[model samples]
Target: MTEMATIMDCPPPGWEPLVEELARRVSPATVIHCHEPLAKRTTLRVGGPAEVYVEPASEADLAEVVKFVAERAVDLFVLGRGSNLLVRDGGIRGVVICLAHPSFSMVEITGERMRCGAGAKLKLVAVEAKRAGLSGVEFLEGIPGSVGGALRMNAGAMGAWSFAVVESVRIMDYAGRIHERPVAEVPVEYRACPLLKNHIALGAVFKCNATTREEVAQRMNSFSVKRWDSQPAAPSAGCSFKNPATIPAGRLVQELGLKGHRVGGAMVSLEHGNFIVNDGCATAKDVLDLMTLIQARAKTERGIELHPEVEIVGVD
Candidate 1:
């Protein structure tokens, strides 16, 4: 049977007891669910459930969750708006904490600096910057996902990266201890911030320049138009592969004659070769199979090694 037709909806074995234990430990306001379906939470809209999904109501609640996971050596996944992600069919094994409560999504401006809670939406940050007559984050308006994801990925668009505007970041370690570090102290390398992988992003402060609202609007509009013209409107986990230094990944896919290529319900978008879109009935395996096909073709036909840009997680 196809993966989509045969996938089970059960939480992992022992998840019930673990969830019961966790529920007793966390704040009452914290939203918790057992065997929470994660498909709807992602941009691709195709994945299994999180064995135990949680949305902490406050920083203290988040810390408590982290502490509980650490003490038991439980696997933990931090979900941030689920943009560039692909969860496998079996679902996650342990805890999935989403920092999406009101306290984590607040935004504040002070002089030339802006503080954004990790859960704050990128689009919202851009809008706030524009409201404050700022210019640095206009590029962020085009990117989907939260500040935490942007910080973790160092997300960039329109010639600017997430770290380029970052002044400092506040992070909580696995042990639930919080620390503040300057951007200079936090090392980042192309679409990755390694520290955030092991730590939870609480918030970040960004540096921006004073600018007229009209100028910011113009730039944002230009970027929006370009993105709309170039990207697909279908459901995708953004770009499938990272751009090779010599050529963009999309152009490479086209060069390989794989644009609009299909493997079951997953297809390379004709609008953008780098995007593998779900055609209403795609499963995680379909997308993965299509990726393998693309990789094989690119390697044999063009001697190119295409690596995925989207983060693939969960079990097989």
Candidate 2:
């Protein structure tokens, strides 16, 4: 009897064929590559790679690719500006879709509302709002992410959150069905939007108030100054943990004497205890280890259960 072929001998479906097929089905979309480096894509700059990467040219193209991947039961992750994400060292398993195409970065202001694609930079949105003499979104000036990420995470800074200015949102589900829903229908909370967690945010309509351009700029500048003073300049995935209801995460870590603490190449930022910065050569494991240490210490010593605000993805 012939020996049975080993799993390696009969390898699973290769990503190349699927990527090719996706490109064919979704015209104008660019299939980047398999094993694409993820470190450079994330703010932390300390991840492995993506098995498949795609950049859709338009919302329609993104929907087509999403539907294709979903139909094949392949895992999909929609990448934003990667400001608050930590990908593991072993890398992601399936397709990683990035909506950073020019077609998805359009921002238009009409009356008191601004309609923007999800790929638009949060800073760009804030600038556009200021240019139009709009207020309310000035807090977004310091957020280092895109609209899609801001929507998904309800991203906030300087006491203002994304949902505060959000009027409506357009999302494409895993099945490639697009839905536009008013803010009332979307459940947004502290650093989370559960309803849209698995959905791809296509665009959003934001409501702003009429204000003097100077006033808007002043507010933006204030937030920028505050951020620059508090956050570290090193590569990091924003805040490492959420602020517990009782006290801010940074203060808590500082009180625990964890600031400047190091685990391998990852260190608790001396500038901001809530952040873990990668010192040029940190690995994902190093960061995870540091996080574990911080959590353990906080829970054991301070009786505080720290929760991570940064999204940790991929595998070990």
Candidate 3:
């Protein structure tokens, strides 16, 4: 089949055309995998295929791809490590852009300030911070997502959150224009951020403080131990629900005697009441059903509404 025909035939509006246009404008080496498996890319090991999944070789290449999609009004989803996401079984509609390649993962440390790309893993960031004698990011060692994902979700643990250490963030709008803004510009609260709908985070600079390497490492280890005792790191998203300010969500679930609640193949982790696990042979419907049940039970029984921590994507 001709390349253009393969990319264009029966694809979503503007999706195939944009792909073909990108193939012409960008170098062949810069674009990888016109179509890729979503299940393999996500930590959950669930989800259907994506029509076009591009791994841009460099920042310029990534920008170009974003611009093309923006101009054409094509649907696009930016993914970074895919740790706290639940992709539906029917698959995504348009393009899924992944920024996990080394070109998007460069890191720099200078005294109390650290600059890292959006694709850098939070765990790796913690380790690097320790080597650089930085302390604020030590709590990030237990986070399982990328820097971009962390910023998007305002991921927090051990009394520290990504936004708390963030001095400024580099962002790229759909038009490919890059801009930097201080943390105050982005409203953050309870694992939520008011990031622009069309802007994707490129990287961030964090104003951390100097500390002894031994001290930072020690804190990271202690935080890890604490997390292991509280969360089910076996195979699940870090937390399933946002803790209400008045009380912890896990504690509430436990109080309701719903620690091991199950719906189909999906079950709330016995280890942590807030986490829902696939157990084995779980379907997307099973997960959705279980979440619905939990939310209902929490409201009807406890007079509290539990908010989901994980982002649900794709069609049912």
Candidate 4:
């Protein structure tokens, strides 16, 4: 078989033509894997395959894929480091684009400023900033996703939100148009960035005050210790429920005696009530079922409705 054939072969059912066309459209350096299993891509380690998975070589290459998907009107999902996400059992129907290329993971620091690419892991950003003696980003050390995902969700950890450190973000809209916006002009809430709801976050520029490297390291270490003590070590999509303003989600779960609840191989972590962990052999269905039980129990028994904090994607 030809090299191209290997990359484009055996697409799930009707996905072959689309994958073939997409492979032809993007640059040769761009990686396209048809019928790629997504379980390995996600932190939860559950879910089926993506009909087409793409890793673009550059921003131009990513624009090509986005343009193609927009023209085709097929569903498009952008994958970061795949934390805080759950892909359903039947898999994603259309194309899933991952910004895993080196072009999208670069992190550079100049004095007290840091510029990060979308695919750069949150942990890496913190480490780099810490190395540069920047203090504000130490909170990001405990977040488990990529900068793009963090921007999208306004992800918070240790009382600091992603946008709090961001001076501006470079975004690519679904129409394949790229633009940069300052944080003051962008709208963000507790856990949502409205500007990124339909657009892609390519990267951001972070402005932080100068601090001693020793201080940054000390802060990161304290946050890490607290996270390890509070959160579970098992494979999970992070927090499963958004804390209602009236109370913290974990506290509510604990109060409701739902911390150790299990359904199939999916269990609410005894370590953190807000997390649902896969018991090695758990399926996406198991996780979803357990999540539903938690929500229902929270609503019926406690008079509070729990909503998912993790992004649930793809078909059931």
Candidate 5:
């Protein structure tokens, strides 16, 4: 609570009025008390308590919360499913907004397109697409994390990335302005995108061609087997490093003899070098050190720069 005690106790000029402002606009049930472990909310199941966590019931409530932070000049974080996040032992400051409400979890399939809110899980997207006889999203069947996080990280596997099927997206800015933009308007790179600043994604429309439901399920089954064989299913961020254009990060780490390397309680997965898993008990610093080790080894051996795919948030 050092972060909160230092910044939130006395009420700074720009952030002090947040509580009253947010309360005026939303129901009390949406707000959670202090000391709730955020680790339970994430796939990794690690980290400290959130000083204040708010789960708005609807999009209107979400908009009001965003506006409240803006009016008070306080910082706000938009969280999806928390699947790929690494929250530090020190809790986050200001407000953390969870957008997994039913209103933000809608999914609609029309023609060959699927429109899904940011909170929708990737697994759900794959299942819905399969039921609708869509072929493209089958590759994402085993990918854990929300659609928003997938778009943010350009999450991909089985020769397809999330952006490959995205037709357009809706975003909400810090000041509560909403904009709908086509895929062409947002530039995408390998595991990165031009949609990195200002706005938070609200939902997206993905264009998928038609296929038989059985074919889609079969494709998804193949992906699931691959994931189960290669990844540590315990508690981990999906992949620790982004693959280079030509070589997979896992392959590079294995080539450098860095697989199974350990730091504190974190170790590079022996099965998949691109993953760092908590063997027993691990701190954020343990994971950080392991990442650096693999990066340095790969650079010295193959001359390729390694970039993190996992989103590292909060204090180090």
Candidate 6:
């Protein structure tokens, strides 16, 4: 994680009251700042700032903060590691809760099942599962997001998805009530978990098959090599578009001659047509414009509608 600079003492205008009230209600859990720049929080390293940034110490504290924000009718966004997200220049309006606290990042294994916190990185979860001699999540080793983000998006790689191994998920509602639902109960589809769109995932339980640790590690290493070979080395939010039913998004973009295309500091990655990389000074608008160009060209030339896989949030 990149170190954040010193936080400003003064809150952003019009958010002073909200910040003060939040500080009182959500004590112990640090309320970092108002108008905190979001670039460092995301993998792409682009984006403006968050209205009110918060880091809850524990699940209970997170719940309290959520309930407080909900009752006051403030818009809330639960940010994970920001691997597959793009926050616009105008920034997020209300509270931005980040589940980076240690309490929300615990990982445990028991009897062929592993439980991981929402804040736990996908790579860490994969390593933990391998340590326990579990298989089936080797694909997660290459994904660049947190477990919660992965679950929310039904994140997949190398023919494996989050829901395929999910046994159950612990989620917290807008009112701060927690519930456990089986995988069957959650409406998980390709690249989406609609049930978790509004609620926040706390942790997930995955059922894995018993396997040799060496075998799991080998599979994981294979996946890592494949990802490194295909994906860009520059900062990016992974694939910009989801693969349509008929064709892979990357292949389609390549066919459309969109590879190496640039809009401002954002460019279509030469290594992978599906990725839009930040060449140090890219902004959210640049990425969005590049996406629009790709979508337009694909639709006009190939009659294929390209849909973004990366979540676009905040005002523009």
lDDT per residue (tens digit) for residues 46-67 in model 6: 8888888888877777887898
Q: Candidate 5 lDDT, tens digit per residue, 269-307?
A: 888988888765887778888888888877888889998
lDDT on C-alpha atoms for all candidate structures: 0.90, 0.88, 0.79, 0.89, 0.78, 0.89
Residue 18 in model 2: lDDT: 66
- Model 1: CA > 4 A from native: 1-13
Please give the lDDT score at residue 87 for candidate 1.
91
User: RMSDs, each prediction?
Assistant: 5.7, 5.7, 3.0, 1.9, 4.8, 3.7
Clashing pairs in 2: none
Worst 10 residues of 5 by lDDT: 1-10
lDDT of 5 at 239: 86
- Provide the TM-score for each candidate, comma-separated: 0.95, 0.94, 0.91, 0.96, 0.88, 0.95
Candidate 4: tens digits of C-alpha lDDT, residues 1-316: 3233235557777767777777777778899887788999999999988888899988887888899999999888888888988999888878899999889999998888899999999999999988888989898998889999999999998888888989999999888889999999999998899888789899999999898999999999999999999999999999998999898999998988988888888998999999999989999999999888888888898899888999999888
lDDT of 1 at 254: 90
What 10-residue stretch in candidate 4 is worst by lDDT?
1-10
Against the true structure, whose TM-score is highest? 4
Structural RMSD, model 6: 3.7
Comparison by lDDT, 1 against 5, better one: 1
Model 2 lDDT per residue over 1-316, tens place: 3321111111125755566566567654344566778999999999888887778877777888888887899999989999999999988888888999888898999999999999999999999999999999998987889999999999987778999989999999888889999999998878999987788999899999999999999988988899999889999999999999999999999999999999999999999999999999999999999999999999999899999999999989
Q: Residue 192 CA error for candidate 6 (Å)?
A: 0.7
